[model samples]
Target chain A: MGIHLPSLLPQMQELGQALYERSLQVSAMIPKAIKALHSTAELDHSNLQSKIKKAGNRWTGAIPTEETLNLTYPPPTVPQSLHVIGADGSQIYPDRHAAAFYYLINIGSIVVSHGSGKAPTIQQESQLFFELEDLYDEADHPVQNAYVNLRRDVAEMKTLTKIAESLAGEQTLAILDNSLLLWMALQTGGSTSRETDRTLQQYLKLLDRLRSSKTGLAGFIDRPRSVSVLALIHLAGLPDDQINQETLRLTPFRGLTDRAIFTKLLAPGHRSALFISASPLNRDFRTAGHEVHFFYLNTDADGAVVRVEIPIWVAQDPELLNRVHAGILKDCQTTGGFPYTLVRAHELAVIPPQERAALEDMLQRTLLGHGLRPTQSQKALTKQLTGQRKQHTL
Target chain B: MPESPMMIGRVTRCSTRGFVGAMQISENALPVFGSLCQAEAQGGRSYVVGLVYDISITDDQFARQLAALEEVPQEQIADGQINRHVPVEFSALAVGFHNDGGFHQALPPQPPLTLASVFSMVSKDSVDFTSQLHFLQTILNAPQLPVDELLTTALRLSAQARPEEERERFLLQAGREVAHLLPQDLTRLENILRGLRA
Candidate 1:
């Protein structure tokens, strides 16, 4: 039986009250800190860079700032002729209790041609994995959904690269609605998934293809809660040695988000200064000439800050950067402050839970057709029997 | 050449009574309020012909706001309408059918199946279906439907379907059928006659 939520009303209210109080306190705390920074926090790029070099062995994720303490650009007007493509992926994880250990990934993508007045090309492709190679890593352990999802992301980029190649002109941008740092999930310090390394190589290869074709690639993370900006705040708050992880926990900006701080610093339609993320995952990109750098843009009111990440190629080139900015801003206008292509792509890609259930039914029917009896594990059967469903059956 | 957008919808629901069924349509320019729709039964062997009587625009708070929306620029209107799916459940009359290349004015053997392709049979095809006014009984009884509108359009199409010599005769027969069906609503009947005469 589930614990009764009504029974814990008093405790829930107490917790809610505490959180609400803390939020108010944080709200007050953040604006004051940002105001102080506006007056005193130098862009301090050189000092921050030297300190970063000094603390290389100790710290991992402080991003290097551009010239200004921050940079915010007004909303860029979209060019007359352009092509915007976006891809999103969703997956049904392999159920251990199913007939076979299998997973499925569905990628949905759209290509919107601006100034052509044509309906966007929307497509969804679903791939099923049941082979041994798909089920296991190089080290032979059964792969989890996380690894499969990363592979799906790689597949999406590969699809984008192919699409970009075919389009060839009119200034294109291919977007993924997630972080560019695919290696973040694979970096567990001691163990590196060789499969991930292979995927990374392929991902970077696609980045090169995209770059050669002049197709801008970006990862758009909306309403991001990242504290990448906190590193700068930490640098400003304490000395190099004092700015270690343990000391960072004690800083006043502990629970504050970069979004929260930037909300005050930036007006709507403005982006912050670029910062090269120093995460271990970003290091590989740096070596491969595609380092991941991010800048926060406030797309709408009520402090909506979306973090946009680009490879070093786009970041280093001003025209490409403007295209990325203008392209995204116009697309946002189409969707009321979100990427319209990404919205359509996600709608095409997301596999509903009912579809997964239907797939299982099909799998059972296929097995029965082959005269090979396949049954769910007893534990799975038991869970199904005991589960409460919003449906009727015998 | 493609003669007008080939309108296609899916059968959302159907009824055993053969009087009414609902088809869900999403088109930028929806089927005219009173039009003919046809559904192919399972295979290509049989078909169910229907009259489009009611168009229900699906609603929620969002759709309400959209409906209340005022003069938007022409370009924005084109893109904005993409989000306004507005699935129309046009209540239809199971008027007649064609089986094995033979046409019959009668109820469908069965209601259209769900998710079956529902095509808006237009132009001469619509004119051919309403050649007989037998479907008017169901149309008249459906109070929710616009009885006057359907009678007028159906008679007009049936008249157009005839040869020039028989056009007057077709309207006379359809008028008699309407007068017989609604003796009490004579004003409405007269209005329908005015529409058919036009």
Candidate 2:
């Protein structure tokens, strides 16, 4: 009714063709890139290593790996009586259209008792941030998106830590549906946000507690684009000058990502060699005794390979690593690509738009009950009017 | 003076003809298929008494995911079932009301408010509610409800809730009352009595 579908059919065909052709081009480059990464990983590029060491916080993006190209395709082996814990977070960002700028975070957790024929136990915790201090930083600046996200990350880890503390017996694996490396915090050159650092401290402490509970923690990133291995690709060029952000940006491997390479590299159940994340955020993690390492796992051949990141404890233990691999593959079989626990956790945690609207209505009513008129933004009022008119025309 | 009936749920959707509520019922202490339940209304000045008719058990997502765990030991699902807050929903048709010192066989002046706590009617309340034949008229006059179903259920519950000696008398009076109310519909009267007899 609105866009006239018949008129756009030809253009849609062209768009699809362009996307298909581009994917083919990306696929063509993977073999050479993989070969370059393998050779560079074998070479002793002391100059690039020195450059990375001095690159400091100013350097953005992933650093390359120096591991053998050969990867292991292990047979899936999950423990019979393992407890798989999955947690995910969903948040309503601070909205300007609403009467008082506020945010809401809901974290959901599911603990599946594998080998125990029962429904998995699930829990959800919700918190509203409308307090004065919560809405703004100490300097009275409104909290930015980055800060809010960091808080959510902290909240998620805190939930996992609590679940670990309360749950006992049976080996536990805590799976996070996100990257463990705090890449956002690392981008703030030299000095990181104070709130981020303190939160990271708490997060690491929780990780320690989870590890102590004998729960191996892993972060699952489906269709990962991180080529910390690309740093090695860049290092192979034999740059004469110390590598800075400028030199790293101009490196040969610009248009490529790791998913294209690993999609061809691994088969179902095969995992790539573990490589430490060159994300600067991992430096603090390394200092605190929990170095983050990642491997590309082809959970299903139909989809892209997933990058599974783990702390030192999980990467070092062959038994834990195998369990993680098998656990992910087994879970993926149910959901087609992602783990079932994560899917359930996300479902439980997500707050739909209807819910957010209802909450805002309630908030507005409560504010009005106290004799305060909650004013709507002019832009929001106009949008509402336009939307109603648009609906009528349709 | 009587044991308090467990508060099962709060009124979610409400009206004079009937009301639905969301209940937190467990696997063990679930209510019967048809039981007498009451809800407080108008600051306890009166109460709405109704017959529990429809019960819908949610937690589909919970069950579907659990069913997927074929690898999980059967015993865990059997005995290891932790306390679950399963949402049990039931809609009840308002049969009568109790005010001051009297029970009427008609709708209350006001519908029970939303979020009102619905309680399992204690045996004493049930015995008292079915003491008279007037409640039968309330069900027949209320055409929107499952009249035959409610009449049979109320009769059976009253018989059980009453003293052992008066149980036969209660059902006999209900049979006579149904025969009188639906004299034109003999088939319907027979069905109701046959249901009660069973």
Candidate 3:
């Protein structure tokens, strides 16, 4: 009664067929993309930048580095003894209909010492925001979810940096379970520009500290939907005069991701050439000397290609870059496709639904014990009562 | 006197006849099967003494997948065993209660509350509790338990709790109790008594 299953069947079948057709198209485009990558390997960086700028700052794509476009580096020599620290975060967003008006962020991290033959060290840090200043902004409105997510990202990065600093002399690589670029903070239109800028500043400052500590940092993105490389390939096939906003907007290879091309190109345990992200926000990151550079890595023989984003510092240092590449590849091999530390970190950070409910119950009880009445909105109560029962035809 | 009780786990579920506790997956020196343990109940006014009958470690989808791999690194194995949240659960059968500073060979008035601390009984306490073998009947009649093997293991552990010279005598007394508890079932009685030797 809730979903009208019979009515969904037709649409579901159509969706399946459409997906099949799209996959065929994507498969066909893979070779073209590869061809474009090879042909443009010698394309001058300045020429590509001029074309990107001439697109009226509308075209965002991968900006090629000195590395050839189609180059695939085999798994680098991973150090015999290395430390890979992964940090992930989970947050409970504030809900207006809930019994409380607050948010909670939990950052979980793991330090895996390869070849040490010892158990990995794991930690979790949780913080609750309930104070008036934390809950509301200067506009007297509750903080947005984007702001909470930004804070969670900051917390995760800070925890990683803290861990890495503690092992300053050791060969350590800190990995984040997200993109290194803080584009979400910059793109969230609802949040105040000043707040967004401040959060970005904090993130950049953390990167500075990490660089100073000489820690290798990377952001691992699984099954990335990014089309940065595909956008670049699209530009490769276009003439200089045709590289305008209208032409860039109507990409011939729409819905195609960089992963598909790399999956066909890179062998197992190999990585594509590194390129800097063309996001306008990266300009600010560039100003801060922490521009985000990324590459596609074939993590496994089954063609599991993931995007690995690193800072300019890591990309500039060959030794550090190799550590990031080899460490992540080795970590992926252990878990069958994804980094083990990131999976463990996510497991530690995730707050299950039952736990969230229990936390709410504890909060409510504490409030009542303190002579304060805590109650959920009527809407929330009705949903809870009905949601637990099976839907009836009547 | 007992030296000291080592807290092993916390009571997660309980009843008048038994209770279950969850231990850390990476807990070292886990209590062996048929080991004697106790849970504080009635706000520590009474202690429900139980014999550990079963200890199990459950695996999730992640662990099952990892196990299928040809090799897993030490870091990953450690992450799975120590960092992952899978619990090592154990079930204990209630056999007696310690109330008024005396051991009673009967179930307590109430089971321990959830989250009550459960501790392993020290050797002295184990010896004192099994001095009288009336708890054998409780073990034999408890549902969903390996009755014969449990009696054998519990009797052997209890016998070991006694002094070296007195172990045979203690097991002899326990064997007699098990025989009396299963009089009509000659095979079951023989099977239990056959395993009661120190």
Candidate 4:
């Protein structure tokens, strides 16, 4: 019988021999590598824990001392009137396909004095602007309204700056919603595609003027990237001695405990402002050096004003910071245990009025036992609507 | 009934035992069964039906058989029709079978009865031997498969045999077949094998 076979036998034999050799070599090597890896892992675990403990201790004692402070000059004279501005923006999405509208509210309040003592009647000014653009639109065309709004903000900022300059004696702090605008202006160096860049440049020039005049400029930006930019700018300007002690620093704290304790611990005459929302436990607030008050500003059932104290903290205080940390850890042990009040307040503050009402309703229902009443404005509005209905029927 | 006499070989010297052992060694080092017939008169025409028995033999057995047969002088032996029982062991090499009723054959027997025919026979038994060999060659020649993939496959196959002895033997055989095809790192191969075990 004729038997046929493929002619590739030699090659196959060669391959088989090679594979056999390699397998043996590999079989011999594995045990050793695994052993080494295990040993290294064990060592690393112990070392890591010790290092962490050491670092925590160092951070605890790291607060700057008064002796380390290098003041180029004494603190400037306190202005007669201190203007604090706060701006918030809310985006509204009606449907999946519809463009969203951004409603911006800029609230500027003139605080007469720097200390806890009341001095003069506060003059409050608020401006509302709307930008209608689809969020899902092409990146290039995404809401040209921001640029228009930016131009308006620049004009307002100039006016505010001029007002600050013209005032006989006042410390003006013009708070912008974001630091990106200022950072971009500083980096643009005159080359930009949009005409708004010119106004932004002017704003930057105004900021420089404020710096020269010793008018403190601070911005509360939500994004970490903006913070990084600010840190970089501060690093470039300040000397090494001032880096952590006076100029640039970062404090990370969670929950209301640290905030409250820190604020209480602040020297009685020292003034500190806190940024807080509804959920105090879940979110992280990053501040440096100075103390901040963490509180909730919500409307009552009638939409009247209501303020709830959550937490307050000065970042430099070790005792208060430790307490805040411990409180957060303790909170983690509970179920559905979030600092909900702060979170809700933040949500209400960020959301537009139409949506805020629904959120407020949900919050009130959930927190009914907490004794939070609706604001007087909400009650009055409801009454007015009902009264108008009765009058129309008659 | 008439009685019919047919020459029957009892395999007085079987190469199976020794040859199989040698083959096992070779395979481990590198990568790489008997029958009788009975005749009886059934019809008036004295028709003879012979039962053929084929013993499955490995490469080593085939080698032993050849070694045993070498003692007989071919010239002195009667020139009768010699019917050898064909072994059915598949060869690791061979191409596709043709429709002409003839399957792929083994390579020529090497000197001292390397039994190239036996190898060919074994190779032809595998239906996909040809295709598989072609794939292996392509892999080796062109490096078609990723090195990681090849290592993983090798390790998995190596891990399949449970006892250390069996695993070693299996890997040895497989390694011989694909030694040149493997990458240089032994650790990588071990890792793949461990992964398979896991």
Candidate 5:
């Protein structure tokens, strides 16, 4: 029998009811917490500042002044080329006796480049096939197949990376479908399934290769497994002051902004972390023997956004972080703003359907002025976009 | 009406020889038995005749054997003799045809007969009869010869039979026999059989 969405309607209804009730409870409690905070403001500030200053004193003895190395070159007029690759796999069992097969779709597109304020070249293409029979025995269960499929996905990623490397230029940005690296040093020599261990080792190896390559790798992983692994890695390398100050703070009331609270409490250069999505971490996260520093970026109606601290030791140098930040900022300006952020200019560059092609043409013209010749594929894409634009107008 | 015992013997031998001759025409033909049931006794004796022929030789040899069986002795038998037993068997010593006079006297006439000749005729006729019998046997054993093959084979065999009454009787019997079989299985078999026929 097919999976009917209607069958899940009752559960969804129940969840909706629960969420409604929970929201009401949070609403009632927030005002009480706000009132309490206002009454305790004076007493809390004096005590908290003293406690924070005492904690900060241990690390305040010496400030190291490292000369800022400038890698920023003269502004090159090359057209900004942004490439985003997102892959998704769906497993389907067509019949009872037939094996469950996975269909993996890797979608890659050239987004806007650094110098050109142009609309990104977006391409959506896919590949489909049956899962290889040799990868698993018929007797193997679904969970085992999940691990196998993950490894298959990783292998696909490696191939994609190679392609990205070949296509990548000095100004190119490669966005992975998932996390670029997984720390699994603690998983080494542990009593885990051989398949699981092998998958972790493969992930680690891929990360190593990506780091060594000239192409920059960024992944958009929505799953909790990837997030927690990132969080753990971030926490391990946290500067001491952040940890000491954060340890004493009360867990904020549920509806309050946890990230805001952490930010207020944190000393300059200190870190605070928040977990979003509430998904269980992937199995590899349990044993990824690495010290990670986690910093909570913000908490708002959109939920918490956090950053995983990549240790200078593993990241090889602190300059890489500076480069990453510079790259992100440059991408923001070139693409009209950061693609991942809610920055106003970035949103404007994402032209609505009706104006997409016209906007693309305008951007292309601008890019041409910067001496970037569009490839043949890009020309075909532009033609298609223009056609779509005409159709939308009609 | 009962024929003379000599005539009955002659007829039985002729029928048996005919059966064996037909079998000898095909090397792969299997030896088979034929049974004819009658309501009343013939010549005051109930008889069941069985015949077989071994045709290990080539077609030429088989034809020579059939020629010998046609020359069986009839003169020695008494007229209108009833309930008499006449058992005749022979092997080829020499074989020659009677020659007409062309300035020379005709060769002495002799009864030409061989046991192989009688056996060959009986076996050949028996195979032809038994071919139909085997079809019936398969229907009885398998009870699932495709309805189409069964009906088509029945129709073909009926068309070939000399007696119309007998053909009608067999056809009626086959219809009643197949009614007990599974319809779908029979239908599928029928389709397969139709393909085979085409």
Candidate 6:
């Protein structure tokens, strides 16, 4: 049966009211979060790191750097000849009922040469996985969606690195439409999975290549829900002795996100102080000299806050960081708020429903050419017939 | 000597009456209005020929949003113009077909298939196609198109394709064909003839 809007009205009204009230509470907690930030701004970096480590807190938070917690830096002048490369990826997971069982990952990238007043170079690469080893796990079952996502993430990073290495002479900044941390593998089966370890190694190798190329890399997360910095603020509010697992499991500012606080703290075209991600996966990245650091930027005057994650090298070099800041700001100004290169990259990578159907049709034709009759599973055919919307007879 | 055919675009939508082809934009130029174009049909055995009647460059929400911005970077404008898949579509009125090494001033037996390459007819081919002047009836009777203006433009282009000495004579012959086709509509014939003169 179709959803009845009239029947859902009362519950929707309740939901709206609850959300409104929660927003108010979140707003009230912002000032408290800010106060906590200022109160602990002067704490030494080593001390903060030791506090977070010794607390054995279950929550992942940000470890403060040398900069004060509340510091906001204005956008620096963009260099005259800057090359910005934005890479994004999309995927189609394997379907059990289709003519074939395979997943596809397409990575799209755009390289814009600033100050040249020329069109950007666009490229896309797609890979299809259908081998038994790719489709099945050690248990010989179909892989989950998480596995497909992990592959896509790895593809994007590899594509970015490959493109960056190709453009050797220019001052290049590589941007991915995600966090730099390769944490998706954790979702596949936790960090201990053999698959997770292999994926992490692959990513570290790519990160090493990017660093060696001296191509600054940044990951742009739009409207990010990360509360790493907020968790830091929460940790600051607690005394040293009370830092137990129970307190870390819950926060008074439950509904609040980090963007909520940074949106208020950062002015237009400014970025907050960098913080080191305290997640366990980041520790692996740190040991490899490519530690992930993040800062929140107000992309525009209307308060579009986006979290930018970079490696230790880019964060350490002032000029590289400013290029990232200014190049992203200028790209955002092209579109209203979001970076245009990333938008174009997504447009290049996305596979809509029609294209997927066309791909299946082509596969069927290919099978037919080889004297094989391609057929969908009975269950899939039935769904195609009955899954359509019901026509109303007036 | 025959001039080399210039590729206009590929046929996106096709029918016996007419076909719509997207213009292959280069150097920011479009196919001239009322120019002759040809697309192959029936497995290359037949060629459906048409006249360019309308050229349109469509705008989407993305372009409109970019335009609404206070300032758009040159690279962005270039990207939108160069990289975006949205093409400039142009409509053509099918007037004739070529088969068995002869030009027939009528619709083809079958419409061109989707993605059939369309090209501007070489000067010698245009001259040969218009030599009979029988295609004027097809353009003059297309009520859905701007008939009078299209006829005038097509005639002018056809006349230009001929030798300088035979240009006026060719136009006069086209004028007569148009007059014969519209015997009763004196005002319309006058407008077409007047347009041809201009």
DockQ, all models? 0.24, 0.19, 0.72, 0.00, 0.00, 0.76
Model 1 / residue B25 / CA error / Å: 7.3
By TM-score, the best candidate is 3
Better of 4 and 6 by DockQ: 6
lDDT of 4 by residue, A346-389 (tens): 23235446555664465456455566553435555666466555
- Across residues A1-394, which tens digit of lDDT does each residue of candidate 5 receive? 3368999999999999998997787666555443443343333334433433454433211111121111112222322343332232223212222222333333333343333433333333344344554334344533333443554456545654565565545444444333333432223223335656566667655545545554444443221222222222222223335655463232334444333333334332222321212122223332343222222322222333323333222234434443333444343331122233212122222334554345346545765888875333555556656655432353
lDDT of model 6 at position A91: 95
Clashing pairs in 2: A64-A231, A64-A232, A115-B72, A115-B73, A116-B72, A116-B73, A117-B72, A117-B73
Tell me the whole-model lDDT of each prediction, alpha carbons only: 0.74, 0.76, 0.88, 0.31, 0.34, 0.87
Candidate 6 lDDT, A88-175, residue by residue in tens: 9999889889888999999999998888899999998988998998888767768888888988999999989998999877788889
Residue-pair clashes per candidate, as listed?
2, 8, 0, 69, 33, 0
Candidate no. 4 TM-score = 0.23
Looking at model 2, what is the TM-score of chain A? 0.86
For residues A272-391, could you state the per-residue lDDT of candidate 1 as single tens digits?
A: 878778777787888888999888887765556899999999988887888888888767753546887787788788887788889889998999999989898998998888786555
Stretches > 4 Å off in candidate 4: A1-108, A114-156, A171-192, A208-214, A220-352, A355-394, B1-198
Ranking by TM-score: 3, 6, 1, 2, 5, 4
> Cα deviation of B62 in candidate 5 (Å)?
93
Candidate 1 chain A lowest-lDDT run of ten: A183-192
Per-residue C-alpha lDDT of model 1 across residues B94-113, encoded as one tens digit per residue: 76776876656777777767
Error of 3 at B66 (Å): 1.6
The regions of model 3 sitting more than 4 angstroms off are A42-50, A390-394, B25-27
TM-score of the second chain for every model: 0.74, 0.84, 0.94, 0.22, 0.24, 0.92
Instruction: Kindly report the fnat of each predicted structure, to 2 decimals.
Output: 0.00, 0.26, 0.71, 0.00, 0.00, 0.74
Model 5, stretches more than 4 Å misplaced?
A1-17, A24-112, A117-145, A152-156, A167-169, A177-192, A221-319, A322-394, B1-198
Q: Of the candidates numbered 1 and 3, which has the greater DockQ value? A: 3
Candidate 2 local lDDT, residue A250: 73
lDDT of 3 at A228: 86
Candidate 3 lDDT, tens digit per residue, A41-127?
767778877766676665678988888878899999999999999999999999989888999999999999999978899999999
Candidate 2 positional error at B60, Å:
6.3
